[model samples]
Target: MGTIRKGANGGFSGKAGSVIGASWKSIDYIRGLSKKSNKPATEEQLIQQARFYTIAKFIMPIAPFVQVGFSQINANTMTPTNAALQANIKTAVVGTYPNFVLDYAKVQISQGSLQPGGTVKAEVATGMLMISWTNKAIAIQNGQLDDLVYILLYHPELDEFLTAPEPPTRGLGTVDIELPEHFLGGKGQLWLFFADRKNKRISRTNYLGELDLV
Candidate 1:
């Protein structure tokens, strides 16, 4: 048929695939017609169609809890509202937002290199997985922020890097980051890092927690 016209529901109704059986009556008749009219679809069209299906089915279902990050931050130089995070305050964050996003997903945070006397914590709805250390300041790479800390998420199934542990929306204390709650349950590990902003010294902490999202 001509483009099979978009559905009244404002979606793709294009019958791009082949029909089953055109000779059979009614149900089978439609299938037959589709099969007979099978035309080689473009790669772009297939990709678009696949993306449409993924959005309509998989991604959209998890949209509600997808934006999970920091909800609140309590510190001397930062609050849930500030963006520029200071290096000298103890910040406590809530897991409510992350709870929603990782209801069933597993994630990990990595701390590359950090400074001393700093601390990092990954607070899931269940508990806190933290890392800390004391000593001289460990400098991040030249271009990297002198004292940089955040979360890192790794996907074992995909054997690839998924997302960088970013700050929650609004910055510092409580920022917003998006995550999918549709996770692969079981024992997943997360890494947290804390960097110290100093010279001639090294400071850092490594914390790992099993992500139990059942």
Candidate 2:
């Protein structure tokens, strides 16, 4: 038994004189065929139009929307936490693809001395890490004058952490990022993580930077 009712199964029914079965010799045949009269179309013209409609109805439902976040990480080290040691960017996105909305809220960092005499920067080039901010606010701040800013990198797969030589400065108050050759191919996200000695007090700040590989 057919699932469709008579009129519900719309389309020409192969009628002898209608568009579906009309002959070129008939009065209702297409005038120029290609550039014909609009009164009634020929069977060939009708069939061509029907095919187009069927195809259009079949392919418009599944597409993907993707978003990306940029940061630098080292490709040769892992943090003490197993994930890459991370310099606090405070704004990194995690997971394969993420959906994020910024919420203006207060952030705070407890623990750790914030001496005013040190600096720190985070960078990444390869591997991944977990980033979260559910209850705790973002920790880590900008560098102060005459502080040693340390750059740390992490390699997620091997679970290692490597520290770069400190860049000596009086008040270079900004995170300087560099991608070197050791990273598998010297490409990808480089995570810069760090700790310093100059800032032993709890009030000093460290800064981190973000960059995308070309």
Candidate 3:
């Protein structure tokens, strides 16, 4: 411990030699003392961070599903699975259209087994919607792994329907869709289900829930 002193702004500060320091912010914060970097985060870094944050929010709910997917595909570890998932999300966001693609071959090892059970949650914010689910597949012994996901969105007021394909994730799965602000007051229905590697529907469709998009 170097020294502790009261600040003019009614705060407290502490110094530990010339290497670390502490400050009060309602609570004490201790951290390495160093000169702040003059360079700010680059545009590319900011973009990457934004993309990662958005993907994290989108995938957090389905993290369990992703883990299970990795396990079923014999990728029973975190390092590679996380790297691949991050790369996939980056590819999706960088493309003209934002949608996830599954690596079926990697996950198709245990095909034709039993279907996994899980829960899903859907939420809408401004111009975006997120769907996240848990990986209940792990609970099943020798269960059939879902190779793909089919998402169906229907707007009753506009009589419009949108369908998209999503990759199957382990531990949990999540997908983000872009919607117009006009859809705010509109009521809609969302459905999800598992499909085979050949793009064939396997499990019964699950009605995730209805959304007001407000």
Candidate 4:
């Protein structure tokens, strides 16, 4: 852009002839309009775009969880969602470009020093879903009793997700969550993890297995 002194016509604020003019910091400037490119994509570029499209389609819906999951990764240049996608695309995605498939079992939501509880169980009681782990006293002794539980249920077929409100602590051993009306006739997958009371620590996510929600 070239700076210009105000003329008899004053400074222009929009397009005039082949150039555009605007004022910044009380100084007037004029720059030529940029040209648009209509270049066509090459075969290789299309394939790469397909792979990115496949991963992005799945990741966008659960981006909120992805941010928390990849918060600890040491990548300063990219967002947490991008970090999670890069990490998962290598191992969790299967098949070729046009048919890329994401393996839910291989997906890692949260990674941290905290360890997961053993022998997790999922059961449907009336309209409530109950999740439990073994030996709550063990966690209390280790100073993780107050770690809050976070549960996520995803219905792949419906492309929907459900989360618990005001989850209980790890010391409770088992938590009962009310199932939504939409989840009554449908089935979905379950995953759970523990976040410390202060929310500074997160345990590796545990896949609590798929359930026939009722």
Instruction: Estimate the Cα RMSD of every predicted model relative to the unseen true structure.
Output: 18.7, 23.7, 13.8, 7.8
Question: What's the TM-score of each model vs. the native?
Answer: 0.28, 0.26, 0.40, 0.72
Please write out the lDDT profile of model 4 over residues 13-71, one tens digit for every residue.
77777899887646667888998869988878877777777667777788877667666
If both were scored by TM-score, which would come out higher, candidate 2 or candidate 3? 3
The lDDT, on a scale of 0 to 1, for candidate 2 is: 0.29
Which 10 consecutive residues of model 3 have the lowest summed lDDT? 103-112
Task: Give the local distance difference test score of model 3.
Answer: 0.52
Best by TM-score: 4
lDDT ranking from best candidate downward: 4, 3, 1, 2
Tens-digit lDDT track for model 1 on 1-214? 3233235532222233554323211222233232344778787676544434422332232222121111122323333122111211112221332121222122212112223233334444432223332223223322223343444444445432233454221114222233455544534445434333322222232434555533
Candidate 2 residue runs with Cα over 4 Å from true position:
1-110, 113-143, 158-160, 167-170, 175-177, 184-199, 202-214
Give a tens-digit lDDT track for model 3, residues 1-214: 5455555444335665665545432454557667788899887777666666544543454443334333333233333246435544544344222232322212221122336346778888876778876655554522344456656666757756555444544334777888866667887777655645543324444566578777
| C-alpha positional error of residue 26 in candidate 1 after TM-score superposition, expressed in Å | 75
lDDT of 2 at 129: 21
Q: lDDT (CA) for every model shown?
A: 0.32, 0.29, 0.52, 0.74
Candidate 4 at residue 94, lDDT? 77
